[model samples]
Target: MIFAAILAGGVGNRMGEVDKPKQFLTLGDKPILIQTVEKFYLNSRIDEVIVLCHKYWLNHTKDLIEDYIPNAENIVVVEGGELRNDTIMNAVKYIEDNHELSEDDIIITHDSVRPFVTHRIIMENIEKTQEVGACDTVIPATDTIVVCHDGNIISDIPNRNYMYQGQTPQSFKILKLKECFNKLSDEDKRSLSDAAKIFVLNGEEVAIVKGEVFNIKITYPYDLKVANTIIDDAKLNISDAETGEYKVNLYDFGEE
Candidate 1:
């Protein structure tokens, strides 16, 4: 059984004045968290989705899920811990305490702010992870990168050939990620971004699935505008079926 854990328990500091965290903020009509959750909820491959949110937002989130995504199954809203890792730890604890999850039970641990993730991206990531060990979408650097020192001259421009910007829908096999998480040191535990990083630090081969540019994380207030435009563009480009139902798989374009 495939499962997804969305880490939606953040109080946005960067997105000042938008105090309720970026996930709860409105992107036009739909909440950013709802949009993020719906992408995976609509997918047949995802069996259950456990939303990790702050203790304060837990009940509200549950109500929002009911109102927004009525068709989803096994949707659980749990109170997250103070720290990010602590929040994830709570999710891990829940999985261990409840379900008999297998190594192949795919866990797509995603950020709640990145509402631009498409159905194709989810399908592609899961498919690739099934083939290889683990995979994540990363973008190559476009501008010059610098290695800086403490207010002094440091190394000159280095090779951009291998540099990449890591994006989300960062997926893993539940058992593998659990094993990696178990081995993390306190220092590494505090510094890690996603499950992929934990695997990399353990010398495991983590594959890359190229991410689309529109799948941007909403941090600042300006990001919402970009996401709105992307959603609008997506609707415009995609067409309806013969029965007048909108084809959700835009990436399945012309694929016989």
Candidate 2:
């Protein structure tokens, strides 16, 4: 069984005075969370999608899915945890309680705000995780990466060739992820920036899947504007063969 864990646990502090979480904010015609869910929902390879939403918005998340997606039987909404990793564990707990949890089962964790994730990326994440034990999607860094240990000054400048900006659909074999996570000390667990680091800290290899430049995460007011532009450009560039209607190209890896 394969699961896609859509993390919608954020409170949107960085997004500035928003009525709701950034995931619930509109991007183009649909809410950002729905758009992201629809990507995994449309994929035939994905068995189920688990949305870990903030507890305050759990019902709203369910309502959004019910209204936006037809026959959403495979999608489930559960209350998210206090932390990102804890939220992932909540999804794991859901799978273990409701279905057969096996070592071979794969869980592909993605940002609920990253609606531009492509089919090629999703497929590659599953394939690579199956081959290697874990995988993280990333794109080559276009700018010089400056490492500043203190906010006051730049500590080091890393080689651009070696630097890559990490993106999601960070995937892993279900049992393997759980095993690695259990080994972490409580302090280490609290300091984790993302799940892939859990494997890295444990001396585990994580394969990388090439990500699209347009796979942007909508975190702030500026990002929402950029997301809208991306959607409009995709519509202008692509047209449906059958309907002769302009549509956003959400599946393909290439630029629209």
Candidate 3:
């Protein structure tokens, strides 16, 4: 089974003076979390959608889903963990407890704030993870990457050609991810920046899936403004096909 884990564990500390967490904040018409969920829910390739939400907002998350999504039996809201990776583990644990586990099963983890994620990115993540054991979505770095060991000065400057900014749906073979995660020492686990780092530290190969620049995470107030503009443009680009399915040309927002 292919599961898409939508991580909504953040409390929106950076988004100062908000009534609720940033995920619950309205993006265009619906909450950012709901829009993110719908992206996966609408895709026929994904079998299940698991929402890992912070404990404090769990009920609110459930209520929002119930109100917005019709017949959302496949989508489940579970309590997130203290850490980002731990929240992902919670999703894995939920899957193991409720459903049959298999070695080949895939879990695609994504940030709930990134509502602009295109269907193409989701499909590529699944396809690449099936081919390789793991994959991370990223885009080429447009600026020179400066490595600063200390806040005072830059230790080294890396070539921009080799540098890429990381993004999610970081996907992995479910069993393989669990095995790699288990091998990590407690200290190493605590220091992890993201799940793909586990594979890197374990000498495992992780393939790359190209990500869109418009696949931005809503972290601050300014981002919400940018997201609204993107939504307006997306509406302009949307059109109906002969089969009666609505196709959104997110590429019009510089996705390619």
lDDT for residue 119 in candidate 3, whole number 0-100: 81
Candidate 1 lDDT over residue span 1-256, tens digit each? 6777788998888888855778998885799999888877878898878899988888889999999988556788988887766776677778878888776777777888987776777787898778766788888988778887765887677889978888887777777777887898889988987668888988877888777777789998788878777666555556444346755534332222
Residue pair clashes in candidate 2: none
Clashes of each: 0, 0, 0
Clashing pairs in 1: none
When superposed on Cα atoms, how far off is each prediction in RMSD? 3.5, 2.6, 3.0
Model 1, global lDDT: 0.79
Q: What is residue 103's positional error in candidate 1, in angstroms?
A: 2.4
Q: lDDT scores for all predictions?
A: 0.79, 0.91, 0.91
- Could you give candidate 3's per-residue lDDT for residues 1-256 as a string of tens digits? 9999999999999999988999999988999999899999989989999999988899999999999996799999999999999999999999999989888899999999998888889889999999998999999999888899879899999888999999999999998999999999999999999999989989999999999888999999999999999898676556433335645454345434
Query: TM-score of every model?
Result: 0.87, 0.93, 0.94
Report the poorest 10 consecutive residues by lDDT, candidate 3: 239-248
Query: For model 3, what is the alpha-carbon lDDT of residue 189?
Result: 99
